[model samples]
Target: MALSWALASGAQSVTSGHRTLFVTLSIVVTLVTLGITLWSRHSTHTTGQFYTGGREFFAMQNGLALSGDFMSAASVLGITGSMSLYGFDGFLYAIGFLVGWVVFLLLIAEPMRNTGRFTLADTLSLRLRERPIRTAAAVANLTTVIFYLLAQMVGAGALVAVLLGSSGGGTKDVVILILGALMIVYVVLGGMKGITWVAITKTVLLLVVAAIATVLLLDQFGWNLSHLLGTAASKSPQGKAFLSPGLEYGKTVASRVDFVSQAMALGFGLAGLPHCLMRVYTVPTARTARKSVGWAIGMMGGFYLMTLVLGFGAAALVGPATIKASDPTGNTALILLAQAVGGRPGSLGSTVMLGIFACVAFISILAVVASLTLAASSSLAHDLYAAVIRKGKATELEELWAARYASIGIGAVAVLLSLLAQKMNVAFLVSLAIAMAGSSLVPTMLFALFWRRFTTKGAVWATYGGLIVSVTLVLFSPVVSGSPDAMFPGVDFQWFPLGNPGIVSIPLGFLFGWIGTLLSDERPDPAKFAEQEVRALTGAGAY
Candidate 1:
């Protein structure tokens, strides 16, 4: 088994002292997070508090939680690893992610908060008769949530395997199960209030760790980023290591295209993410939502800028061979680089830095999983069970209980899927999730917000069409085909050079939405449509 060998290799790379420290930190964070969840359950009893924190969260508080919701292990570790391995090309991802918030602030933030209550489905179906539109929106939301959750859970397993110094499938599976149980508790007990608090704390911690690492790394080279870039450029062939264009610095043309497309997908997809949009509802007014987006942009921009230093520092000191050796598990690049910079794993400085980095990673996972659980639970309880099955007759207590049960069920399914995909590279999984969000959810959400001509039929057709196209392309993409035989045997077709399908699929989503609207027989009442637009733009009816 290649998976067993890979896990064994990871085990051999970690020192006993490092392993002990990592496990202890993980257990402690897990316990504290759980304790908070249980405490919050007693305090939050209504569906309003469970889903949107009773609309009482401050703009700054929700902004910090938005930061946590957006920055996952993929951004924290994967982006740092990419920058370290690919030079300036890696920072491109950081730029794309931060710039995406500008789009959110200008186009989607206030409108989304004013239009929806618990989920995006609630907004899209507000003007329609409800059943048909709600069902379609729920389907789209659930598809994106499941795909994203699977990627996060798989990343968690890989991170645990690396930290614990174990290469066993059994070990990785155990980690997934443990994480799933913890995440279920986080959602069912803590609800929105607890999730928001944890996310805010985690975001602050992540920003501090990244800032400290960047400063220390730059200090190591005498605070000269240009000098470091010049040296790396000279060593790399074609002298394009620091340049923004072309496929120099050891990356192929295909890899370059992959990076660009992946960035676009991640950037645009942020606006469409159900969990991120849901956070806006926690704030009281449309003006507060606008302010929260502004805060998120500033925080995200600062974090991305720091990532450049860490990536370049790793490239300058850690070497390419080391990154290649750990390509299967990119999340470890930052950890390994930390060890390299601080002397050895057992050194006093190295241990402290490693512990800090590991805690940041753990919190990143916890925050992301909490968001995913909320998104999935909202779809199941609010959209499907309450709106469809019960015809909107369920009591508030019944709705709350249904959401809690849904959280557990969703968490369980995610754990199983993650264990099955444990041996695959997490970067590919993350890109796939981004592609799905961009293709299926982004176009529909944007059209709904900005276009008055968008019809119920248009929304339904576009959402389903985008979902089908993205999921199919991802399943047959090069990344999935090249996965270990254990995961997919004898499948050898490659339809796209870049594993992420957003480059083509995103355009197709827009096309479908446009065409579906054009062909629809029904039109919304002009008076009601105008009123909805005014409220969305001005936040007049959000309360």
Candidate 2:
């Protein structure tokens, strides 16, 4: 279908046979994914099945799905692109992201699984006043989801245009619409079961593709790591500096602070993401959730290590000038790398290899968008629509209907925002999302789970205060203005010095929670604390 579309779509600039082959492969993969999603819809009969996969997935299966949920197109394209363009500075992002999983495994996984029923609100509401805490948590969840989903969709539109050989016209807009519709279908029809299977399948394919590409790249220098590094350094415009840090970021004190801020967000923020936290509920027991995190850490850490191969390989072979020419954001580095490593353009073998990588990238985008849609929809339905609107009396059927409609609504909003965000850097947006999650969700979660004196007022203050500060900082930061990479480059009203505000916003989150609790006269309930501690520790009352 992609091949047929390519032939008829009048994408004349992309006349190469290799380009056509990639389009065909991308279409084939997408169709198969759609088929599987439709098939999985049959299993989603109840709200429980739709929301949590009936809590039946084994630890390994859930682990792979978690990997899929975590590894977005931004990670594959943006990280590689950054590495290709900036060298060691880009790899820092990968390290930060990988270390986040360690934090998840050590402190968050078991307790989150044992305590939460569905969303982050479930865990928070266990020991706090239900209405205010759930409402606050829901708002925080939606904010993170909207920002993250918009980044993914924008990246998807740009990537689809590049892959389809049509960078101009309305091709990108059309592709965004179709992708949004497909994501809605995945959530409304297939639910958690379908999304989980898609994630699991995509994660394996992603890992396999990365490993193969890495080996082929290593073979270019006869498996000599030193030789590969030397060649890449020579090829880079920065020479030896490219092999070191400070190429992309860290030029000044402010920039260095920004780098640390971004690393802090990536390391602490990922564990608080609603989609990842929701995955904990898919497994039946806390032990399974713990084991799932172990699998995820192994897989994610290994995959990130391969970014060195793809990023440096691209710089070594294709050069940054060519990568930047295709997309100023360097998002097209990996695609060009595939073409360079796969023999040459117009050759059958090269075309096949390029197509495989294209499919890997497209499938990755699909899996992540589907997971985000599900997370957003579930939060709306379970936390707001059921808990708030219906006062915890909403029936299963009503909640399911709400979820389906919410998916469509959320997908539509994401598509619209993505179109506006096309000119922005995908990696920056992704990191910003992580930073916001870290500031808003992580502090509240830690306090609610660990602090015996945490109050409902504290939860609301922390969640809302962190969200407002993070968003405000981003709006006024260099990322939104002043710099060439800023979202609104034409207008320069930048106030914040650093692009990332995690350094300030994270501590503010914890501070707000503490201050709100102390200022308020609301006393801590011993019975509630005892109940939550037992459940969070022993998995006694977990669904």
lDDT for 149 (candidate 2):
83
**In model 1, which regions exceed 4 Å deviation?**
1-10, 231-244, 248-260, 328-330, 482-490
Q: Tens digit of lDDT per residue, candidate 1, span 1-543?
A: 001113234455567777777778777877777777787787679888999888887888888989999888778787777666566666667777776788889888888889888888877876654887788878877878887787778767767777777666777788789889888888988999889888887899899888888778778778888877765555444365354544322367776666666777878877777788888888898889889988888898888888777776776676555655665433456877777666766797787677778777878888898888898898899999999999999999999999999999999899888877776655555666667777877788888767888887777777887878887877777766754532353586766666677777888888898898899998777776677788898777776
Against the unseen true structure, what C-alpha lDDT does each candidate score? 0.76, 0.83
Candidate 2 local lDDT, 1-543, one digit each (tens): 000011112233233675677678777877887888889889888889999989999988999999999887777877888888888888877788777888888889999888888888889888788889988888888989987887777766766676676767387788789889999988988999999999998999999999998998899879998887787889887889988889867688897998888888888899888889899889889999999999998888899899878888888888888776666666667777887777766566567777788778778888999999999998899999999999989889999899999999999999988877666655556656777799989999999999999999888899999989988898888878898767677899988998788899999999999999998789989999999899889989888
Error of 2 at 114 (Å): 0.7
Question: Model 1, 10: alpha-carbon shift in Å?
Answer: 4.6
- TM-score list, all predictions: 0.93, 0.95
* Cα lDDT for residue 330, candidate 1: 36
